[model samples]
Target: MSGQLYLGLDLGGTKIAAGVVSGSGKLFSLVRVATPAHGVRSDLRALFDAAQATLAAARIGWPKVKAVGVGVPGAVDPRTETVWAPNLPGWKSVPLRRLLERALGRPVFIEADRNVQAMAEAWLGAGKGASDLIFLTVGTGIGAGIISSGRVVSGSRRVGGAAGWIAVTDRWQPAFARLGSLEAQAAGPTMVRAARLALRTQKRGVLARLARADRKLTGETLVRAARQGDARARRILAEAGEHLGRGVASMVALLNPELVIIGGGLAEAGDWLLAPLRRAAKKWGQPLASRQVRIMRTRLGADIGVLGAARCAMLEMEREKKSNVDFPSNQAG
Candidate 1:
């Protein structure tokens, strides 16, 4: 945290977060705005407004910021500076970097949200010391940020860690149309749906009672019921865990990462979800890869996205400096 400060933006389906972070990975301040449901116009306005508010709250001027980084919840191609975000309607290669740069008057780098989250983890979270690690974030959709040999494996198409797209089964259901097989089976919405379906066969339980009453059956509901020792709720989570475990096994076999850090809404299920996931990974993963990999839930909680975005900006500044680009001088304030 001894180096210059940078600005980072984390854009999500529900909110947009902006923060000031140090080169050494300390977040100084943060501001958030609810994402507008109208359209891209509203979203862009909120994005810019959040940035301005973040700097104001930090008591820092734009000139004091070295650069900017954005984390989008989708695929990002740095070569083309385009994004393919499923959550953002009518958005594809929208030139997000240019938009932010024009508004903020600084170099803006846009990255995949998973990559950004992984960056934050590698910097100061669960992955701090692991040279090879996977940040598997499971929420609206499943995705991964893979760090190999201390560098992000963005792949040739900048989609190296699209973990949700992994096929956990041979059967393709209609639910897999939008999200991947693994995600369709294990993500939040999918888990909720599974819990509701379980109510058909298991007639009496906390989850069953909720579904019978036509009340909202959300991820939180499932976790609460499972914690209360509801068999049906625990079974739903275990089923989802089976699919997630298979997904983990595949990643372990292919990437051979030292650590797999799970984060997001579903990871809060604790051992109810993790136990089966670990068992499957050990059972199905390549023997050598399975033996050494350790899986754990993220401790950073809600702050991961904001911190990741800031860390991404800080890292981009370092990258530009290494490439002999004209790095901005961060003068003392």
Candidate 2:
């Protein structure tokens, strides 16, 4: 057994996942629990319970954990150690780091979920060896993490990677004001909404039938339908991809990253989405920069968030060690 181990937690709206990760990015044991939909106190308890179960499953104790890192699905201000996640109600400006540290009796670090995913990619996934990279997560929501010159660009306000807010249209919808312009046009809900709106006028195709049949439509349903050769579903996906591609093109023009890795649930659309996205990027992106960039899907899959959290903890541990290193003092005459 290694002397050093880290606990990594991924806090999502529906579930909380915890894992005991080694220094080499290997996950020893993982545990998951349904996230409490209401009450901040209950959700926090659920998080700790899941962590305890994960540690027990790994046959480890809290004493073995060197540090803990959490990746949260919201805005996390590292300076303030606070979090503001819309999905988790009543979590506005919550002192997450202090709370976790108190509960676990160990040093704790909290970071934005997208940033952790990007960190994992830079350290061990598709973006490995790349100094300049962009990780775009297109799931139920849209967000991005930028790694420029081998360092994460967290921005002055720590919200630099909020790519969902990028405006892609000349006219703004009220929804765009809340969900961000790019996300309003391209995210999972947006895709389903577009399909539903299309079905309202034209009553044809599998998507239309599915929309009429199922009161609730999801991005997964659309992707599955597209795979089965549904024209409407394919069209909807392509439209969403074009919007995402435009956003990507803008990112490439501004950052000129060596690689852009797309992850998250919507990424499952695969070629149905990527084909149109690549075409749009070529058509709209800055000529030279777009041509030189390589965009690919994430390789880390479901473990990206947890692994990224572990990486953050490892980095924090290293920084503290370096800062505490002792240097021989020169004797004063």
For candidate 1, list the clashing residue pairs, or say none: 1-24
- lDDT tens digits, residue span 57-175, model 2: 99999999999989887787756778987667788888988999999998898878888889989988998888888899887678888888887877765677888888888997998
- My TM-score estimates for the predictions, one after another, are 0.87, 0.89
Q: Cα deviation of 256 in candidate 2 (Å)?
A: 0.8
Error of 1 at 24 (Å): 2.8
Give the lDDT of residue 330 in candidate 1: 14
Question: Which 10 consecutive residues of model 2 have the lowest summed lDDT?
Answer: 324-333
lDDT of 1 by residue, 109-193 (tens): 7788888888888877988888898889877678998888777888777877888889999997987777778888888878877
Please list the residue runs of candidate 1 whose C-alpha ends up more than 4 Å from where it truly belongs after superposition. 1-3, 196-217, 324-333
Model 2: CA > 4 A from native: 196-216, 324-333
